[model samples]
Each structure stands twice: as C-alpha cells, then as structure tokens.
Target: MTDRPNPLSDLNARSREVFRRVVEGYLQSGDPVGSRTLTRTMSEKLSAATIRNVMQDLEYLGLLGSPHVSAGRIPTQLGLRMFVDGLLEVAEIGDSDRETIDASLESTDHDVTNMLDHVGATLSRITRGASLVLAPKHETPIRHIEFVSLGADRALVVLVFADGHVENRVFTPPPGQTPSSMREAANFLNAIAEGRTLSDLRSDIAGELKRHRQEIDELARSLVESGLAVWENAGESSERLIVRGRANLLPESDEGAELERIRTLFDDLERKRDIAEFLDLAEQGEGVRIFIGSENKLFSLSGSSLVVSPYMNAERKIIGAVGVIGPTRLNYGRIVPIVDYTAQLVGRMISDRTKG
Candidate 1:
C-alpha cells in the first residue's frame, strides 16, 4: 500500500486540540461552539481570545464554518470526514445491544425475508436512524415444474419451489404442435427438472436442446427454451433490499427546510435500485465504509450519509450488506462499531445456518 500525505500535519498542537473540541461539541449538540465554551472545557486554561484565534485558523482551513456573521463555529462536512477518518474514538458495542441482536437471529428456520426485516429493525432501534440490509441470494431448488395451456399459442409455465411457493410464467410456444403434445412435454421436462435449481436445470436443458431427439416436438422444444428464458430474465430475484425506520430519519423540529430534506430523502429511498447499487460498492471493501455528505451522489441533494458493511457466507464470499442512513453529522464514534458488529454477527449467524 502507498502512503498518502496527511493534511493535518501542518496543524499545531493547539489548533488540533481546539479543532477536536469543536467537532466533538457540535456532534453532541448539533450546535456551534464559541471560544469561551472551549476555553472553560479545556484542561489547560487558555484565554477566550487565544481559542478564538485557533477557531479562525480552522475556519480558514475549511474545516469549520459559521452560519451567521457572529455565530459560533460548527464543523463542515469536510471537518466531520476528517474527524471520522483521523481522530474519532470508536466505542465498542455494549453487551446489551449485542445480546439483543444475537437473540433475534438465533433461530435458523431460514425465512430470509423475515430475518432481514428483523435485522433492519434491530439496527434502527440501536442507532435511532433508518437501517438497510442487502439480502443474500443463492441458487434456489424447485420441487416441481408444470406447463399449462392459456390459449391456442400462449402457455403458462408453473414452478413449485421447495419452500412451498409457486411462480408462474407465460411461455410462448412455437407453431405446429398441439396442446396435448405440450402437456407431454411438460410432464417429461418436469420429471427432469423436479429436483434441481433453475441454474442447474438450465444446463441440463441446454444439453437436451443441443442433441436431436425423437421424443421432443416443435412446441415442446419452444416450451423448454421459453421456460428457462423466463427464469433467466427474472434477474437477481433471490437477492433484494430491505429498509426500515424511515420515520426515524425525520427530526423532531418544525423547520420547514429540514423537513423538506427528509421528504427528499424518503423519495430517494423509494428508488431501491439506486440505493442497492450504492450498497453493492461496499462489497468491494472489507469493513465499515463511511460516505459523508456530497460523497455519494444519490444522497447529495438530501445531505445524508451512509455507514455500511458487507456480510459474507461460509465460503467468505460477500453475499449482502448492512448499513445505516442518517444526516451528515452522525454519531460516528458510537455508531461505527455498532454497525460493524451487526455486519459480523449477521454473517456469522447466516454462515452457521448454511453449514447446518
């Protein structure tokens, strides 16, 4: 790995101390800090004038900004990123929270959708913000496959999954074969595909399509092609995204502008494809990822942030992600470890179930 230059190298000890206090204060209260406040709080008794000079220097460096002409200083998005990356003191997830998460996932009945819903709800309760989970996907096996005629040409292909759910697709048959022949085809193909997943069955179907056969007719051949094509076109059906606690994103204030931002963020979340694609990026990394305001294009307008981590299966391949979404000035030190542990716990629990 290459060593990148540190931007804070130029800051003197006094300036760094003053910057840290300012950012910490702002994170705790979401309010700006005056020099007098820092002066009284510091271990060393520096005069208010000296603290003001350091604050001015930090502002000049673009780490702090003032909302009003004479208002105290608050850390900008850049300052928050710097603090999170270089100076924040992360807290370990408490035993209580860890137990809460673990107990919920202890059962391994394998209802993936319900498990993810529970995971999201747990994160929201812990962090007081919206939670997102990218669901893991695998090759699902089918218990049965049947073909039913809808009309003269259009046919319905039905798939019965091992989980007891059924999926139906409209299969268009080629010209020259009767519905009765199609029934024969469905019976023969069902016998072949009953015990395999669509992925595995596709290969078998491909092999059959490759060779000449006396038992298969034109419509039966089309039925095989179109049935497989439907599942192929379904496109990542096993993997999905689940979000909860959207109402948590809204702050308890009457400020119309902030409320408008929350509304915009809700709209962004409704478009799952954008958020899902962004979460997919976290799979490339090994641990928790922080995307500050304006860093992720999807949330730039809403001025939101995301802290996400990818979870893996027993094979160590990343199968999904877990994350929190909130305002830019998140409680980074406290929340980072919580999000990280949740990801690890989720991966461990899912991997254990898979092993069973």
Candidate 2:
C-alpha cells in the first residue's frame, strides 16, 4: 500500500505533539482549534508562535484547513486519516455493550433477513448513527425445485437447497396454461431437476426441447417456460440492505447544506442496491475495513465514512457485512472495534447455526 502524507512527519517532537493535539481537539469538537485551546487542555508547553508555525506546516501538507481567514485550524480529511491511523486510541467495548450485543444476537430466532434487520437497528441504537446490515446471498447448492399452483394461472416456485434453506418466488403462467398443465410441469421438473441447479436445469430443458422431441406437450412447454422465466428473473434478485437510525441525521445543527446531503443518503439507503454493492467490495476481505471520505466511490459524493467488516461462515466463507455509516467526524476510535466485534459475533452465530 502507498504511504499516506503525514504532516507531523517533518516536525520535531514538540511540533508533532502540538499538531496532534490541535487535530484531536478539532475532531472532538468539530470546530476550528486554536493554540490557546490546546495550551489549556493539553500538557504540552509550546509557544503560541511555535504552535502557529506547526499549524501552518500542517495546513501546507493538506492536513489542516481554515474555513475563515482568522479562524483556528481544523483537521481536513488527510489529517483525520493520519490521526486515525497513528494517534487515535480505540476504547474497548465495555461489559454493558457486550451484554446488549449478546442479548440482541442470542434472543433472536428469526430467519437471516430478520436477524440482519435486528442487528442494524441494534447497532444504530448503540452508535447513534445509520447502521447497515447486508444479508448473505443465496449460494447453497440446489436440492430440489417445486412449483405449486396458487390459482388464477399463478404458480409459486419453491426452491430447496442442500443447506435446508428455502426461498419462494411467484410466477404467472403463460397465456394458455391450465392447472393440470402446471402440475404436469412441476412433475416434469421434479423428475429431472433433482440435485441440479435451477440454472443448469433450465439450460438443459431448453436445449432438450430445441434439439429433440420429448413427451412434454405444447402446454407443458409453456409451463416450463414460465418456470424457467421465473428462475431467470430470480437470478437478478437484488441484495438486501437493512438501514436504521436515519432520523438521527435530521438533528445535526452544524450540517446546514449537509441536510440535503443527508436526505440524499436516506434515499440511497432506501434503494439498498448501491450500499449492497459497496459492501460487496469490502466483504471480499477479512476483519474491519475503514473507508474514509473519498476512499469509496459510492459514498464519496455523500462525504461520509463507512466502517465495515465481513461476517464469515464455519467454512470461512464470507456470508455478509455489518457496518455503520456517518460523517467523517465519526468516532472511529469507538466504532471500529465495535464493528469488528459485532462481525465476529455474527460469524460465530452463523457458524453455530450451520452446525446445528
């Protein structure tokens, strides 16, 4: 990885200390920090001239910026990244946090989707920011596919996988199909489709129908087309994104023009697809991954930060990701370990479920 530009690198020990103090103070208060504030709050004994010189150096390095000509300096994105990388100290999750997380994860017996929703809500409540949980995709091997008539030319296609997972999709039968034809189609599928993937079965059926004559009639063919069409459509089923704590964004007094930005973020989260895709990129790795402002293309426009970690299965395959999204002033020192610990908890829970 390329090394990041560190403003403090070129400074002496005292100068570096002053620079860090100013940045940390600014991060904590979300305000421009002056030398007087640092002198009062910090033990470092630096002359105001020396502090000003150090701040100027930091500003030149792109770590500190002044919103107004006379205002004190604030940590820019580069400064935040450097401070987060080297200076920030993360506090461990206390016993209360552990208890709360354990209670939330342990007491829930719902399906994966509901569990993710619960996790998102719990995380948002804990962090006071928007929380996100991406559900595991359907990747288990197919065990069987069954089509049941739901009356009025609609059929419910139920898919059973080797992991004992089942999902249902509804399909409308083609123009001239009757209930009898649907049953015949289901029977045909069950007979030849067992132990095969839905995609593979569809391909084989289509090829067979094109190349050779089979016992299946025109009506049965139409039913098969309907079933296959449903399966094809299912392939495009979007990934699930669960978000909570959006209302918290409404109360930020400092974020003026950012209110509209937050509104856009809420709308984007409602779509879920974009966040899912963003998490998919991060889920390819292990442990917690922090994406600061402009680091991830998806949220770069929002000028937000994401702290995400992948939850894995017993076999060590990534199942999903859980994270929090908020402004760059996000308490990374606190949220990083929180997200990491939650991801580990989620992975263990999923592994236990898979075993039992």
Candidate 3:
C-alpha cells in the first residue's frame, strides 16, 4: 500500500497551533481569522507578523485560503480534513443531550417510522443544521393484516410485521366491493400471509389465486389484488428518506450570496435520489464519517459538510444512516459526537424492537 504523507509531521508546534486556532475561529464565527486575532488567542507571546507568516506558510501548503486578497485565512477543505483527522478533540455528549435523545426516541418507541422522524427532528434542533434520515428497507415477515373501510371507494391496510413494526397504507377499493367481501379478502390474505414478507406475499399472490381460484369469489379476489397492489407499490419504495429542519440552515443575517447557497442546498435536499446516493457513502464503513465540502457530490454545489453514521440492526447489520448538513464551517468537534450518539441510540431502539 502506498503511504500517504503526514502533513502534520511537516508542521512544527507553533505552525500547527496557529493553524488550529485559525480553523477553530472560522468554525465558530464562519468568518476569516486574521493574524491579529490569532496573536491574541495564542498562549505564547507571538507578534501578529509572526502569526501572519505562519498563516501564509499554511496557505502555501494549500491547507488555508484567503477569501479576499487582504483578508485573513479560513481553512480550505483540505485544511478542515487535516484538522478533523489529526487535531480534532471531540467533546463528550453531555447528560442533558443524552436525555434529550433518549426522551425523544422513547416517546415514539411503538412506531418505528415515527421514531426515525423524531430522530431527524431532534438532531436538527440540537445541531442547528438540517438533518437527513434514511429509513432502512423493512423486510420483516407479516404477523397480522387487517383492512378498514375509509369510505365508499377507499380502504386502509394495516400491516403488523413479525418484528413489531406497523405500517398503515391506504388503497382504493374496486367498484361494487362490500363489507363482507372486504372481510373475506382480509381472511384470505391472513391465511396466506403468515411467515412471508410483503414482497414475498406480493409475489405469491398470483400463484395463490391460481391454486385457490374456485375457493374464493371474484369480489374478494378483486379486493385482494387491489390491496396487495398497494403493498407492491409500497414495497418498491425500499428506502424512505426523511429530511427535517431545513430552516436551520438559513443564515441568521441572510447575506445575498449565503442565501443563494442555502437555497441551492434546499434544492439539493429536495432531490431525494441524489441525497440517498450520497448517503450510501456512509453505509460503506463503520462509525462516524465526515464529508467536507465537495467531498460528496450532493453537497458539492452547496459547499456544505456532512457528519454521518450508519445505524445497525439487532445482528449489527447496517440498515440506515443519519446525519446533518450545514456550511463547510461545521462545528466538527461537537457535531461528530452528537451524530455518533444518535446513530447508536437509533440502533439500540431498533434492536429492542426486533427482540420484542
């Protein structure tokens, strides 16, 4: 394997400290850090000129960039990577934060999809960044199935999975359908749905009808087909992407350029397919993954950072991912741990549900 050069090794203590301070300042204020600012923040008595020369050297290495010719420096994407990989000191999640997550997730413990939505909202509220949650494709066996009449033309199908997850889907009933036919249809589905997944049941429906054609009538058969058709369409939706707290991404001051970038990000968030593809990067590995600006294609145009981690199932299989998106100057030290903890909590809740 080829060895990647350690840029931290090239820097002496003073240079590293200056670079760290500049990046931290930029992350905190979302603005450039001048030499005068670094001079005061430094522990040792270094002149602003000394700090300026260090900043210039750091920029020469492509780790820092000056937004304006005369302005102070901000961490380039490479510089942010360097700091995150080498110098970042992640703070521990405080008890209050832990309580917040626990309380939010527990409130919707009975409903798995609702639990995920709450997780996204909670992360967004805490981090002040838009949260994206990708719900894993559910393949659990059907435990119970029921049909409820909504009106003359519509019915609701409630599916209970073996893992204790419940899904409610509404479908249109065929013409001339009645209460007895719906009940008969429910019975027919219950008879065949045992120990089979939604997709499995959908596939087996045609064969089941062929075998039991005489046992069921046309009305019941139509209702069954319509009901399963709804599930078939639902099954095609393997993964559900939930995005919340987009308003958090808007800058408080709302500069014209920044608002344009935020608008671009909002547009990016609306493109669920692109966001899902981008999130696939997180599921490829373990633990928290950081994608700085332009590192992932979805956020490239927005110039944002994503701190993502994959949540697992009972068997420790990667099921889905959760993360936040904000400007490149994200508070990595704090946000990293928050994302990590949230992922773990989600996994635990899923595991408990599976066990139950």
Candidate 4:
C-alpha cells in the first residue's frame, strides 16, 4: 500500500485554493481547467497570471498536469487521492436518497440475490456509475441430502434447502466404494444437516466425524469430503457477484482514446471474478475504501476510480462488499458518503432479517 500524501501542508492558502478549484472544476466538467476560468469563477481578486503561476507551482509539485501543452491542467491521480483524503468535503446522504434505497431494498422480500440486484441497480441509478455487489453466502438451512450413484466412478449429490432451493453437485466416488457406503454418507449428512447452513455444516463436519470416527469407515468419509469439495468449488452458486448499469459508464461524447478507455473499462467489468477478488481489499478495511486510477489493478488500464465498502451480518462480521466504478473525475465528496451509507443500509437490512 502506498502512503497517501497531504498536499495541503505543502501548499499555502493561495495555492491550495487554486489546486482545489482545478480539481473541483475537472471533477465537475471532466476537463482540464484553465487559470483564466479560475479567475472568473473564484471569489478572490487574483488575476489569471497569478493563478497561472500557482498552477505552475502545483504542476511542478506533481499535483496537476496539462493533458496538452496549450490546454489547462487537471489533478493527477495522486492529487485526487490527496484531495479525497484531506480536502474533500463529503456531503451527508439526503433523505430522498435514503428513502429510495429503503424502498428498493424492502421490495426484495428478503431474497438475498434479489436484494443485491436491487442494491446494485439502485446505486448505479443514484450515482450514475456502474455498481458492483458481492453477495454474502446463503445461510439457508439444509432440508435434505441425497447421493445417487452415477455408474461406478461418480455420484450425484442433491442438496435440498429449506428455502426450496435445490442444487446438484457431481461427486467422484472413492476407490472400492459400494452402494451401501453412499447410503451411509447420505444418512450421515441428513442426520446432522437439518436446520444447519452449509457453512455451519462444513465447519462442524470435522468435529462431528472426529467424535464418531469409530462408527464411520474411510470410504464414506472420502465420499463426504469429495461431495463438499465440489460444492465449495462452485463459487458463483455460493457467493454471487452482481454488476449493473455498465452502460452508464459510457460518455455521450468523446471518441478516440477516451472511448477506447471506456471500452477497456467495460472489458474489465466483464471479469466479475477479478472485480470480486479486488473487493476483498474493502472487506479488510474498516469503512469505505477508495481506489483512484492506477491504485487498483482492475481499473488501472481504464484510468478509473472505485468507491467501495463492506457490509456485515448481524454479528458484525463482514460477509460481502458493494461499490461503484466510474471515471477518475468522480464526485468523491458525494459518492463516498453514498457508498458508506449504502453499505450500512445493507448491513442493517441483513441484520433485521437475521433477527426475524
């Protein structure tokens, strides 16, 4: 992790104002800002020449850069990080946004997948940026487990959950396995699986088997291990990653290189596995995590930014992450709090469901 800079301390009042204006203007218009424009917009009586000198000093300090020789300057990724970490004035989430989020999530009827979809769609709509949601593991209790023999080498493990969700996993039978061993494996799972989640069962399996090691043979133990391994390997089924509003990332204008960048960002978004893995960085952090431009590997090629936060369950354990992806000039002051509030909202809803 790179150390974040505090450019404010390095700059005096006049230079700080000029730098802030440049960054804020770029964020607002997605274009470099000229000193003449700053002179016109600023309340201070500074001339364009003075502001130009200030911008030159900022540019020398690696905080601002001109896209072209004659063009105005914009904040570098490092400058954006400094502004977000030190200077950005984050706005509180409005009541209307809260109402919108509450309404959208409540209508999902406690379905985990639906809730995540609604969350992604709602955040995308609200922020006008692409949204990503990594859903928590489903905690639905197992209703029954059945192992049907598939010839001599493979078996089909059917798991029926209390939520009426049925999942089928192909299990490879152990050497010298018999039909009787399959029945015993299924019976053992059924005996302990009722009203327990797959995560719970997975953890308890080792303890349960160790306690009753004398009762079960090696073949059935291998069958159980293989069956659970198959399920564990199915990452998508157990923990879904949802992305929405990718079209929002496309700008109405700007062809050529900018268009190419958006295309690259679209390609990056297509790899849900990579994005989901990237979100693990958020889960490790305390609150909202911001990745600007090259700070994150997935968005580096696209020159994009990410604002992410992790959501937790009733016990305050982080189980998933949610975030928005946008161009580097994203309104960090606004989007940061929105992401934070959205994560908290999701945690509350999940906690409520757990209590119920």
Candidate 5:
C-alpha cells in the first residue's frame, strides 16, 4: 500500500485557495476551471493573470490537468485526493439524513439478510450512488446433523438448529455408504457439534477424529468429512453482499463518450464476486478505506471511486464491510463520513442483536 502523502503544507494560503476553487468548480459542475472562473469565484483582489499563474503552479505539481492546450483545467485523481485530504469541508449529516438512516435500520428483527437489504438501499438513496454491504460470515450453532441417502452416491444433509430452524444441503456420500453408517455418523455429529458453530464444528470434529483414529468406523467418518467439506464450500458469505441502486451510477447527461464511461462502470458491477472479494480486503483495514481512481484495479477502467469501512461485531472483531461507489470525483467529504457513520450504525445493530 502506498503511504498517503500530506501535500497540504506544500502550498501557501493563496495557492491553496486558488487550487481549491478549481477543484470545487470541477466537482460541482463536472467542467474544467479557467482563470476567469477562479477570479469570479474568489473575492480576493486577484486578476485572471494571477489566477492563471497559481493554476500553473498547481499544474506543475501534477495536481491539475488540461484536456487540451487551451482547455480549462480539471483536478486529476491526485489533485482530488489532495483536496479531500487537505481542503474539503464535510457537510454534517443533518437531522433529516440522520432520520433517514435511523428510520431505515429501525427494527428489533434479527433477520440480518433483511436488515442488510435495507442498509444497502438506504445508503444508495441517501448518497445517490451505488451502495453495497458485505454481510458477516457469522456461523450458527448446530443442533444436529442428519444424512438421508438419495441414491448410491448422493445424500441429503439436514442441519437442524435448537431454535427449530432447519437447513438442508446435498452432497456426494462416500463410495458404498449405507443407511446404518449414515445414522451412526449423524449421532456422532450430534454428540460433538452441540452448541458449536458450523465452522468450529468442522474443526472440532476433525481434530477429535484425528486423536481417536481407531475409535470411529471408517464409513461414518467419511460421511462427516463429506458433510463438512460440502457446507464449507457453499460460499454463503460472499452470496450475502447486498448491492443496490446501481442505476444511480449512470451519467446524468447524455454525452456519448461520457455515457459510455458510466456504462462501462455498470458492466464492471456485474462482477459481484470480484467486488465482494475486493471488499474482503477492505474488511482487513480499520476505518474509511478510500480507493481513488486507478488506485485500485476494480474501479481503474471505469474511472470510479470507492469509500469503504469495516463493520464489526460486539467483540470488536471486524466481520464485513460497507461502502458507496460513484465517479472518480464523487463527493468524498460528504460520502466518507456517511460511509463511516453507516458502518458504525450497522456494527451497533449487530452488537445489539448479539446481546439479545
């Protein structure tokens, strides 16, 4: 990871003011900034020539770029990062925005999937950008495990919880497995897997079996191993990533070339698996991971940006992540704090549910 540089002190007050006006103008209008525009936007007693000189100084530092020789200047990704880091003032989320976020998450329900769906949608609507929530890979404690023979090679594994919730999965059984061995395997699973999470149970059973290599019948052991492998490989964790309001990422205007960029971004979003995997890396970090244009390959081609933060459980352990995605010059000041707040809100909800 490249170390984030502090370029704020590199410029004087006047230079910073001029660069900020340029960046703010470009961000708000999506149009390049000229010396005349800067002179008008600022109240200081400065001429267009002075403004042009300051812009030239900023351009020399590789912060601003010109699309053509005579075209007005726009902030490059580096310039945007500098502005966000140094000059941008984040607008506080008002009571209305707070009410929106709080109301959407208001429920005593422990149905996490439903809540995550709401979270994704609310963030999308609030930010007017594509939003996504990387749900935690929380494991449920097992009540019992059962194997029903479907044929010579396949068997259905019925996982029943103490709360009476049941989930079923089918897997290939060991060669020549019989009903008697399946029943015995189920019994063995029940004895050890009680009050243990699915992930822990797999490890627990495997460790126990290794210790007592000769105690269990070979057929029963094979069935248990198969069940573990099947369920663990299902990838339910990645499946729970809720992405919403992707259509909001489209360009507001109808310029053919500009419209194609947003279209490319939409196409990139179809790779949810890749997005989720990239989000997993975001989970490994602390607070508010900002991936600017071309900084991360996921959004490089689309010229998009991402603002992500990890959501945690009661144990203070990071479980998943949440974020918003938009154009490279997306409102970082506004979206960063929103993403941070939403992550904290979701973390609190998980903690509350865990306590209940």
Candidate 6:
C-alpha cells in the first residue's frame, strides 16, 4: 500500500515553534498573523527579526502563506495539518463538561437513535459549530426473527439479533393474503433463518422457498418473499445520518465565496452514503482525526475542518462516528478533546447498552 505523505517535514525547534504559534493565532482570530503579533502573544521571548526569519522559513516550507507581501503570515493547509498533528494542545474536559455529558447520557432512555441525536446536538452546542452523527449500519448477526401481522395487508417484521438488538419494519402483503399465511411464513423463517446474518438469510430465502414447496402453499411463499423483501429494504435503510447546527456556519461572512461551498457541503452531508463513508475512514484511526481544509475531498472546497472519532460497542466493533464541522479557523485546541471525549462517552453508552 502507498503510504500517506507527511504534511510537515524538516522543521527545526525554532521554526516549529514559530509555525505553531502562527497557526494557533490564525485559528483563534481567523486572520493573517504578523511576526510582531507572534512576538507579543507567544510566551517565548523571540525577537521580531528572528520571528520573521522563522516565518520566511515556514513560507518556504509551504506551511505558511502571505496573501499580501506586507500582510502577516497565515498557516496554509500544510501548516494547519502540521499543527494539528503535532503542536495542537487539547484541553481536558473539565468537571462541568463531564457532568453535562454524564447528565445527557443518564437522562436518556434505551433508544439508541435518541441518544445519538442528543449527542449530535450537544456536540454542536458545545463547539458552537455543526455536528454530525452517523449511526451504525445494523451489521449484527441474527438471533431470531418474528412477524406480527397488523391486518389490512400490513405486517410488522420484528428482527431480534444475538446482541439483544431489535429492529422492526412494516411490509404490505401481496393482494388478499390472510394472516394465517403470514404466520406460516414467519414459522418457516424462524426455522431456517436463525443464527444467520440478514444478508445470508436474504440470499437463501429463494432456495428455502423452493425446498419447502412440498409443505408451504403458494400463499405462504408469496408472504415469505414479501417478508424477506421488507427486511432487505429496512437493512438498506439503516444508514442514518444526523446533522445539527448548520446555522452556525452561515453567519461567518469571512468564510469568503465559500457560501456556495457551504451549500454544496450541506448537500453532500444530506447524502447519507457519502457521510457514512467519510465516517468509516475516521473510524480506522485512533483518537480524534482532524481533517483540515483540503485534507479530505468531501469538504475540501468548503475549506472546512472535521474533528471526528469513532464510537464502538462492547465487542469493540465501531458502531458509529460523531464529530464537529466548522471553518478551518476552528479552535482545534479546544474542540479536539471535546470530540474525543464525546466519542468515548458515546462508545461507553453503546457498550453499556449492548452488555445490558
């Protein structure tokens, strides 16, 4: 496999310090940073000439940019990536923050969807930016399956997995099928589909139908097909994506002609498949992964930053990802830990629920 290239290389101590301060300042104020400003704000007592030389070295390294020659320097994409990877200092979650997170987790009921939604909204409020939560795609192995007919051609298919997870889908029976037919279909499924994943069961449903023709009437076969199709459609629909705090991105006039960029971003986010794929990438990494500016193709045009972490179940399977999105000027130092802590808390909740 080709290795990913490092964003920063060959910076000495002094140059790294200069680049770090400039990037931190730019992230704070969303402005080009002058050498004099760094000399004043940074704790180290570096001379303006020395800072300017370091800035020049950074610019040469493609880590810093000067929009106008006279203006101060700002961290380019390379600079932001470097700072995030190395110099960024994450603030620890304070007692109050922990209390708030615990309260949110404890107050919720057993509904995973509700818990994930609350997590997304809380993250958005905490970061003062938009948050995204991509929930699990329901990949657990099947323990048992049940069908409950609601009459009038509608029936509820209740799926129970080995992990004590239950999901339901409603399906319409093929014209004029009786509830007895539905019952026969349900019995046939429970007999043959136990301990199989939904995917496996779906592939073998037709074969089961053919083999059972001696016992099951045509009505039962029709109902079985309907039930299996409903399950397949519901499995396909399990990809859930929740986005909160989009309004937070709109008020920043300084985001430049990126207004349309934000629109495109929202559209892309609306496509759950893309968001799920993006979250899957983040899930492969440890801790929080910060995607700044053009580092990721999905939000590259928007000049956005994504701070993401995976939430996992007790079995250590990643169940989902939760994160914040904002302009590249986001407070990485603060939001990094926030995202990390939130992911951990979410993972804990999922694990606890699964164990219970």
The number of the candidate with the highest lDDT is: 3
How does each model score on lDDT?
0.75, 0.72, 0.80, 0.79, 0.77, 0.74
RMSD of 5: 14.6
Query: Which candidate model has the greater lDDT, 1 or 2?
Result: 1
Q: Candidate 4 residues 1-356, lDDT tens each?
A: 33655767878888888988899999999998998899887768999889989999999888999999989999998888888877889879887888888888878886666788899999999999999898776679999988898888988988898998776768778677888899998898899987899988977975874565333223223333434212222224233112133344345533223334433543543575465668667778568888998878788899999999999988889988899999999988888888999899898888887677
Q: For residues 1-356, could you state the per-residue lDDT of candidate 2 as single tens digits?
A: 12766555667776667767777776578788987777675566767777788788878888788999988998887777888777777888767777888889877884666677778988999988899787676766677777777887788988888778898878886667777777788788778766677667767886875454233122223333434211122223332222233355345433322344434543654455565567567777787877888877677789789888999998899978899998888878888888988999988887787677
Could you tell which candidate, 1 or 3, scores higher by lDDT?
3
Question: Which structure is stronger by TM-score: 2 or 6?
Answer: 2
The better candidate by TM-score, 3 or 5, is 3
Indicate the TM-score of model 3.
0.65
TM-score against truth, every candidate:
0.64, 0.65, 0.65, 0.65, 0.64, 0.63
* Model 1: how far residue 165 lies from native, Å: 8.4
Clashing residue pairs, backbone N/CA/C < 3 A, model 1: none
Q: Model 5 residue 7 lDDT?
A: 66
Cα deviation at 238, candidate 1, in Å, is 31
Candidates, ranked, lDDT: 3, 4, 5, 1, 6, 2
lDDT of 4: 0.79
Q: Where's the lowest-lDDT run of ten residues in candidate 4?
A: 228-237
Q: Model 6 — TM-score against the truth?
A: 0.63
Candidate 1 is scored at a TM of 0.64
Question: Residue 80 in candidate 6 has what lDDT?
Answer: 76
Residue 283's lDDT in candidate 2: 70
The parts of candidate 6 lying over 4 Å away from their true place are: 1-9, 42-47, 140-276
Error of 6 at 115 (Å): 1.0
Indicate the residue-level lDDT of 150 in model 2: 80
Could you report the Cα RMSD, in angstroms, for every candidate shown?
15.1, 13.9, 14.0, 14.6, 14.6, 14.0
Put down candidate 5 lDDT per residue, 106-149, tens digits, no spaces.
95367777788899999999999999788776477888888999
